[model samples]
Target: MNSALQKSSSIFRTAAMQVRHTSVTRYIGTPPQVRISTAEKCAHIAVIVGTILAGPAWVLVHLQDYKK
Candidate 1:
């Protein structure tokens, strides 16, 4: 039992050391800027808003069935 405990503790220590080395992140530089036309911007906003509202709209439309 003592040996098993030592083995598990050693395994956990090695895993912790590996995790410390792997979690490093280096930022290179600023990302490039993107340019979009007014129409394209409007389309993107419309799509995003539509997606956000679709779920609630669906639930409201089917709320009676859910209550039943």
Candidate 2:
């Protein structure tokens, strides 16, 4: 019974190793081209920056109310 358990454990480990090695899909080619107009690029950046700043700005504006 001990030998049987050891054999099954070894088989499970071997299968897991093979699956781990073979399952990965690698990308070797150049990335696909993407085009964005200047206006659109500016708008995207503005949205991201505004979102990051809005949280802190809101907290600062409400600081007096929070102290109550």
Best candidate (score: lDDT) = 2
**Model 2 accuracy (lDDT, Cα):** 0.91
Off by over 4 Å in 2: 1-32
Model 1 segments beyond 4 Å from truth?
1-34
Worst 10 residues of 1 by lDDT: 23-32
lDDT of 1: 0.90
The digit string of per-residue lDDT tens for model 1 on 6-64 reads 99999999999888877754434676477778999999999999999999999999999
lDDT of each: 0.90, 0.91
Q: TM-score of each candidate? A: 0.50, 0.52
Give the worst 10-residue stretch by lDDT in candidate 2. 23-32
Give Cα distance to truth, residue 34, candidate 1, Å: 5.1
